[model samples]
Target: MTIKELETRTGMTRANIRFYENEGLIAPSRLPNGYRDYSERDVHKLLKIKLLRRLQISLSDIKAIVRGNRLLDEVLEVQLQTLQQAQEDMSLAASVCETMLADHVAFSELNAMQYLMTIETGARERRSDYFEVKGDELPQVHQPWRRFFARFFDMMLYSSLWSASMMLFFNQNPSLQSDASSIIEGFIVLMIMLFVEPVWLHFFGTTPGKALLGLKVESDDGGRLTYGQGVARTWGIIGKGLGYNIPFYNLYRIWKSYRMCSDLETLPWDEDIAYTLKDSKKYRYVTYIGGIALLIFMLYTATAMKLLPPNRGDLTVADFAENYNYYLKYFQMDSDQYYLDDNGQWAEQEQNGSTVYLGIGFSERPVFTYEVVNGTLVAVGFETHIVGEERWVGSNDQYMVLSGLAFANGQKTVGLYSKLSQELVNAIDSHTFESFEFSQDGIQMRADVTYAGYNDFDSGVLIPMDGASSFTYDLLYEIRSNNE
Candidate 1:
């Protein structure tokens, strides 16, 4: 008979049946397809086991009787004596309860000591073979929340570090802003945690998060886990507890693990390993919160730094392009901004017609000129012209144009001349002019603003032309060596 048929015949749940099978109580043969084939004899054996269990016989005694290690009558005789003694104890307890009720004793007024003495005396005289219930089979200690938060803290720390590394070293933004990127980053962090967690467990018996939360993972012998054991336990946690952090399924696995933990069942990862937690204190929690805040701050600061170009020292043309792109992306100003081509030439997005700069439309591309001293870009300049036919310059348009120039020029404080001298911007800020020149600490900045007629495309210079209405701004910045 199949196991289902066996269930029907024996009226036992699949769990119970499987449990009994695991306990070696019954061995059903497997058919060709590897499904259990229960015999009629197996059903009889299950029924007998069920009857014996109802009689309050322990599984060990039943097994002994079934395996011919002990006679059924002998086990029954022992069970009978044990039950009669239990009955007498219960009868004595009932008599005591009746006496207390007859006395109309209030619980608060009742003498617990007196009742305990009477019960003890009665047990000593009547039940000579009685033994005290010490409750040695109590459930193991489990702190599911502490364990969870420790791992959470560790993962957050790892994520922050990984984000900082990616931004600082690779110039790649590791953001969790999108679902796909978040999942990929999360999986990578999980893998990193798995690899590093075992090392901590094996050497120190705890990780930073675990230590903060007063949790430790140890071997069965109450020592730090061996590396191999730690690896196995970590893998168990990743697979069974976290479900490999897969979408949707990870939640299910976490829920299942939580339920098991709440029920005081040993988690699979902790089968042979011991996970100990100390008594929690208020200060630890406060410190943990502060640490989390610090980590978040670190992540934000790294991301901000990544968004800014190298803010100090002489830069290459590529570095200048990076700063340009950073500004473009930061303000979301222009989609057709500049970039360094593969051949180290400056390039812009291909446009259909005219491009807008500082709210002014222009048909010609902006020109970039640079002076490199020994491969170090020492000076850079940008010039663009806006003709009158493109757009009429109202007061607002003129103000915007001037403000844009000031903003662009001020960026030198954080870019080209930033490392050269800090006082350059301070000096510039204290004065106001349509065009100004500032030289300090071997760094020189010159801004020449002029509104004129036409652009000299051939000569590559801004010169006065007849019958022309154009506005042009030229910004020339230079950094000189001490010897020069």
Candidate 2:
């Protein structure tokens, strides 16, 4: 029979059935798929447990009887005596209440000391141990909210560290796309916390967040947890308390844990563990908030720095290329425009047909070439043949290409405007097509636009749009430092 069928037959809740099983009162066999396979014996056993529980039998006694350590009748006899003693106490309390009502006793004038003395005397005469409560069994304090926030703080700290490390060392950014990559990233962070949290608990008895909240997780003996105990407890919290942080199941587990804590019941993870809380000043909360805020700030700062181009100070050719590539990648620009060859020289991306940029068609992609003087980049330039099969040199397409070249030369996206002269900027903005050159602050800029064509052959055949009859053109743009 299934558990649901068992629930129906025995008239017991799933929780009750599971609790009894956990207490070793009933042991069900497991099926191939890891589900419990209950039998008729389990149904009968659960019914017996229900009846015994109704008779106020404790689970410990029931477990001993189920295990054959004690006879059922013997346990029943002890329970019956305990119940008879409880009945006597209730009768004595009821008699006192009846007497008070018969005398019409008012609240303010009630003889409390007289009633207590009477009850105490009755209990002594009956030789009952019910009123002799043990002081050592007092309930321990529970701080569910504090514990939850402390764990949350620790998780956030771990996530931030992971993000910063990936961005700074690995040059990898968190994925903005909604995909399994995000879930995988979260899993990695959880794994990191799993291993790291145990070390903190073993050595310090608390994590950073727990320290801030004045909370400590100790062994039952009130000492720091051993490494093995720490691992077990942390794993228990991840599995039973947090449901391994799986989406909807995590919420259910969290609610269940909260209820257990609120009811002052020992959490499954803390079964043989102890939690101690010191009197914390109110400023601890402030510090915790500040710590979380600082982590978030650092995470964002790292992301921004990773996305930005390299610094502008006297850069080598490789450094300049790195900055340029960073801009292209960050903006998701077309990456097929250029590439580095085997000798580290910029080479145009090869294609079967012409490529277009800023509405202007070209026979080849523009390639960037740089001159390095004394290990510092001093000049950069590129030239490409523009297809004129259906376009003219003075058309708007030419103006658009010129404008794009001006923007590219200024390195506008990277905020490196010092590379372009103001005179060149104004001329380009004014759509001045004639060859012009200007220098400012040791930086020189020039542009050369020509209308021409050339015959190109490949495999003894004329390449299309490469003959002099075709009205093709070429554009050359360059920027150089006079210091070179």
Candidate 3:
């Protein structure tokens, strides 16, 4: 028989027959001209597939039937149970509709709470079901995969948000990075989960992830949870769901949460929330579609970011100063009182008072500033802050980096500092500060007037000094400042 004959005999469309053939459910011999030549076996198999499909038997089971691995009665038993369960669900839905119709409930008033109350009332009257122990104990039961995906979606959302916050909140001083950054990021994620997740459950009874899995959060007593109960349920899952990066505790929570999501029994948190999960496949095939969409979104973002080139590694400070935006990617930097000049270099808004420049280095995080006097890079400097101390070290020291006082890596990172000079420091210390200038390696150093804080030297902090260094002033400062 030809495909048209097979289609007519099986009462299935040609497209449907072709799909089953493509799925490897039925194979027909190819004629010499390359056209399909269906046999009686193909027709018989299609009929069996069609019948089982009407009974809602899975294709895999039908394959077993076609291969003679299982009897129709054996397969029908499982189908019968599924049909019975579906019938019960339909009866419950019909009852709810009947109640609404009896109460003259308006379509606008037919919300989740109304349906919930209707179902609970019906279940109680029949003595067939209990919300706490009989049905799903929580909204996430038997849905480990959906729970895993919900967390994945959440983490991906937070990862992108945190990456953006590197510019949003900390764009001014990223070098302040510490353990506190992680805590703040976690807090932000928590707030979003609370706002978006619970509100969604309140209205729809399913999260975006669970909606795809055809799962809904069933209420505790047939009616919906009170506002407090909703909060408890949301936090019970999410609060205990994440462990704030607690060493092995986070992993343990993930594993335990996964188990709770998959198990039929109530989780420890369920005692507080008092809810269970129920299948709502009739709502839609959302999980599959949503999962695929989310997967695509993640891949696109990751690929786009990975394809971009990294910061300009070869550009010098002078080169960056000439056109900062060209190499802006390299600097993990933000400033509140800094603006770009026509030359594109960063300019400070105020020059009279001390201003600290904090930034992430090409190496480690560093805090420092460059001294500028009368439009000259007089001497670049670095500073080390002791949290409880009142004073700053490397505050005025120009030989800081080469002397091992503020170095990162080795010579490769020297460009991160200003030109080294001892003449300027000596002039300031001896109260001989006057308008004088000297040039070295095309960079200049100069001081305007006498220093006022020389008497404060007794309380000064010592900067690191290297006995043997290649700095032009390493030996000069070592011999001169050793006695000071």
List lDDT for all candidates, in order. Answer: 0.67, 0.70, 0.51
| Per-prediction CA RMSD (Å) | 22.1, 23.0, 15.1
Q: Model 2: what TM-score?
A: 0.49
**Candidate 2's error at 307, in angstroms?**
3.8
Give the candidates in order of lDDT, highest first. Answer: 2, 1, 3
Candidate 1 structure, TM-score to reference: 0.47
Candidate 2 per-residue lDDT over residues 67-126, each given as its tens digit: 889999899898888889999988998998898789898899988888788888999999
Where in model 2 is the C-alpha error above 4 Å? 1-141, 175-178, 308-312, 326-484
**TM-score of each prediction:** 0.47, 0.49, 0.41
lDDT of 1 by residue, 370-451 (tens): 6677876666554444445433322122112222222233343444323322254444443222356666445555555444
Angstrom error of the Cα, residue 239, model 3: value is 2.3
Worst 10 residues of 3 by lDDT: 475-484
Q: List the residue pairs that clash in candidate 1.
A: none
Q: Which scores higher on lDDT, 1 or 3? A: 1
Model 3, range 116-225, lDDT digits (tens) per residue? 87677866765544333543333435556655765576555555555555544443223344677766766677666766666767777666655665555646555555
